[model samples]
Target: MRPSVSKPPACLLLALTSIFLNAQTTSQPVISADARTVQLERRLETISSALVAARQQVDQSLQQIHELQQELAEIKQQLPSAQTVPPNSSSSIADPLAALKTSVTDVQERQDTLEAQVKLHDQTKVESDSKYPIHLSGLVLFNAFANRGNVDNIDLPAIAISQPDGASGGSLGAGLRQTILGIEGSGPRIAGARTSANVNMDFFAGLAYANFGTSAGIVRMRTASINLDWPKDSVQAGLVGPLISPLSPTSYATVAEPGMAWAGNLWTWAPQLRYAHQFPLQEDKHVQFEFGLWDTPSSGYNTSDVLRSPSPSEQSRQPAYETRVSYGTSSVDRGLQVGLGGYYSRQHYPYNNNDSWAATVDWRVPLGARFEFSGEGYRGRSLGGLGGGVYKDVLYGTNPVTGAPAFVGLNAIGGWAQFKSHFTQSFEANAATGQDNGFADDFHSIILPSTATSLQLRARNRMIVGNLIYRPKTYLIFSPEYRRIWTWPIYGQGNTADVFTLSMGYQF
Candidate 1:
């Protein structure tokens, strides 16, 4: 019975068996959840490690940024402060542009100061050199001459003390007429004023083999003077010859004809004071004027007698005065020149009784490429005893009376003319004539045999002269001259003389 039950439940038993068989035929593999969870943890750990390393790099960068900020703060602290510059600031401030400008300014100021000082030094040197100056000069003259006699025979003594002889002769001679040496100089200003002076000496030697005995060796003062110049004019004082007289056409030197007479009367040196002024007149033209007072020597017989007896006292006699005015024209084409001048002079004798006055006119004419001629004429008058008087007296007798007494009267006239021939530039000719008259015939007669006699005297005198001069250069002059003089009633002796002479000279 059981077997039947165990074997059969046919539907149930078969379903169960079928299910078991199907499960076994379609089986699937399976894993634990814990193992998966462990893998997940490991991956998460790797990710965390990477994140930590990134965070570390970021922190390091931040630290480097903080250090850089500190360094920037230190750099800012080292920079200059912008505070106002202290008054006593010794430490230089940092301002490149301003410093450069200040340096440039200082350098410029120093340079200007140096330049000013140099300019001052140069001006001082120039002034000093101008204030003090020196000069030197000299002149030498040589002369040759010939003479012809034209006079009545007269007894004349010889140098050997032999008896007087009546001998007529002619002569040719040579001489060193004058040798001059000069020095001039000036001194620096004192109290804004300057001073100057000049001195010169001359040596005159007599001719040899002329039969005329003379003191051959002699030294003389040619010029000596002191000058003081002001802003407008100048003054000079010294023992000087008559400057105006020499310049006048009728003066002694100018009137002395070739063979007639020599210039300048041998007289005592006259001391004088003079003043001169110069001013511009017109374009390239000028004018100059000068005046002076001179001390006239004694005229009357006394130890101080200069020319004659009855010498006037200084206080009673009027001072000798001279004046000159000159006008110079402009230097036109080729430097031509024209001039005009006038002069006047007066003198008083020691006796106060004799007075003299003179007037002169001068002229200069130039012919272009031909020559130049200059001339002058003077008129002189003497009143009272000045007409005539004894000039000098010696122990034995008396010298020729130049300034004589006894209604003395004098009239003198002279002139000179020069010409240059076109044929020779170095060749020139000069001629001159002079005349002096006393008109004292009546006075000479009354004075009869007395040396002071003035009546019956043919006082008229004549001088004729000529010169042919050859100038090789400015410094050399070769001249052959002829001079003639005719005197009537010579010295109240009713005698006459005609003299001729020739001369040559050199200059440098």
Candidate 2:
């Protein structure tokens, strides 16, 4: 005869298997404390389910034990005193009863443990002062770079500039000023819409004038918005991206300034009130219409930082107007989108009143599962405040013919396009090029003078960039980028520069 052996309950086997699998998969990066909490919650859920099954099994066993007790009583009544029953029989009944009791005790202990763990998890959650749900997200970034020619700024340079006299070589540097922090919260619904708000800040304002100022970056507000969203309509008010030109190239190396800032990317953030409505179309297609009132300051109009004064645009006592219409497929990847936009504003300068305006077109097209293309184009005048026209809004100097003060809004046309290949969920590559050209005729004879400021003379700027971004973990990123910039002045020879950068960041 084979020897008899005790077997563990099925619920216990299932629970142990789940725990072992979870442990095996959790070798991946934890990302944040919140992620660990989520893991714990899932584990507790699995264990709780097992405990429920164990409890049911115990209940069934108790029912059988009660039936067995009743059967024994009936047997005693039928067999009479002679049925003193075998000693072995009493031992067998007691042993099975003991086993069922042990199973019940085990399940109860597990349930208690699960309850304690759940309570602990609740105690560790972050709570907002107002008792609303709040989230904190940010990136800690480090960048190292090298440049091969003269440029406007060493770190995150935008345009190439003429080499100064006696300038011998390029420069190399590293910094962490691009790090960012953001806070967001959701509020109670109001006016039949969900309300939420977010604010983002970065340490990229500028360096101090003191020692080691390179590492002492000032804090700056990047963007902030309050949103009221319904099923198909939404309203937003805050410091946000320009409504006319809505897209930017992908780059981790140019966070302080967006990619291709002076060379076609018009990505200035400003205060605005926006209203948007979406119309659902056939299939997964949709159309969106956006209108906004924006506070557009004049380019290079403010000379004093310590005093509060109205900008040229503000002095006009009018806000900029912007509108855009876009068509898109609402697929998981947003398969295709195309937009057309318009902008108009008035600038009141001491010398004259000028108009700042633009007409824009933007597009995003997916080539396939792994490739995509995106771009934006615009023709505008006096758009320097919007990161256009080589960062100049107008040419200001004495008129050559009249010998009087003259101000001309610079006419400019610019655009940027990028080809992106997403090789996998964690790796990608991008190549892009852009150009912003200010009409040389707009400058007239202003640049011929030996006394004119350099900003007033630039006529065109162009750039090409290529980068590879890799994410070994969800919360970590690494990228290496190369960029070439060419800048032209209304007078004299053009300048070119080559920049190389490595960026690493951790996000949470």
Candidate 3:
């Protein structure tokens, strides 16, 4: 004879199916790709809670079954030894006990099903050729924008410029070049330190400018690093931003170059080897020191797209040096912090050698639970490659007396600050402003070359931005942003432009 079988209740079956579907289809928004792990942890917690409740109900049922069996045994013992139960009475007593056993078996099957689900979830990981595990994360971002005046790069403008003859005066467009993709992995620990690596890329290298140029963006590497992290020290080597200028205003609308690229944010990524050490303090506070050697590029110079050439800094045959010291809460994502940093490089030019240097200060202060302030400021010369001095490292012209080419490193001071309000976990607002000013004295008596671009003579650039980001669903984001830029040329009237953008993104 076939053995009896029990099926799960319709409600329980439906709940399990829903959970599986949710895990496969739903995700949470994270500040960065690394935060994907946090979202996964939250999902696991929810499932664990459900499993615990079901187990508790099964335990109670088992206890009641035991009590019933005990009572039946006692009643049987009280009867006379020769007494025989009637068929009908025996049927009534045994049927209920058999039913109780079946119920317990059903609950046990449900528990087994839940355990299998958790095991399956744990096994759902990216398969790698190597023994180590790998994970994939990314953001698919779409941006629609409208510009009310002439500006450089219509989709991702950095500066306002004077309108030329027959100019359209404005433009409306959309694109997906800001989308980012990343891959991360972990390796075996060595010398009491954990090892990890990640690489990020986007389609922001350049545009095709063809019939479907907006849809055809070139792929480019954003940043990549291999890190060894100890409890109080770390080492990183890869392409990254300058060590002296680490803080940048947060804005999804400006992911290609960050919130303030040419207008004050010194964020040109370069290959570097860096080391950091931390000193623990009371509570959550700590002090850190960081140093790095970077392969800085030369700004205000053109390079061939088809051939490789050494930049002025590279021609110097020496790497740039940078160092920073900061004190703050140990949290890397957010908290209170203040940092001071410095950068130095030697640039070899055809005419002469120039010393490129900067002093920088950055800060992040929490005003309360819902608000925070962050900013970075710097004073430097010959910093155009690092996004300063109005994108000009040095001004060149004919010397009046000697009739020989002369070059002078451009001096500039600029910074950006932002005020952020986190009204809730799923919504926030931000306002920020930045400026990059090249001193007028640095531009005097210099005759711009005929081959120079219109922006080569730019003396100053200022920008203001405001935006609201809302997350209606866990992994969906919608943001609307406004930006205004004012730019002044060395010998011409200043120009202005206003930009409005709507950005939508899905994270996974």
Measured by lDDT, the strongest candidate is: 3
Segments of candidate 2 deviating more than 4 angstroms: 1-126, 331-334, 445-448
Pairwise TM-score winner, candidates 1 and 3: 3
| Model 2 / residue 80 / CA error / Å | 81
Model 3 lDDT per residue over 230-308, tens place: 9989999998999888889978889988889988899999899999999999998999999999998777465687786
RMSD in angstroms between candidate 3 and the native structure over all alpha carbons: 24.8
Question: Cα RMSD (Å) between model 2 and the true structure?
Answer: 23.9
**TM accuracy, model 3:** 0.76
Which model, 2 or 3, shows the larger lDDT? 3
Return the clash pairs for model 2, or none. none
Off by over 4 Å in 3: 1-121, 208-213, 300-302, 445-452
Error of 3 at 432 (Å): 0.2
* TM-score for each predicted model, relative to the true structure: 0.52, 0.75, 0.76
What C-alpha lDDT values do all the predictions have? 0.47, 0.86, 0.87
Write down the RMSD of candidate 1 (Cα, Å). Answer: 33.1
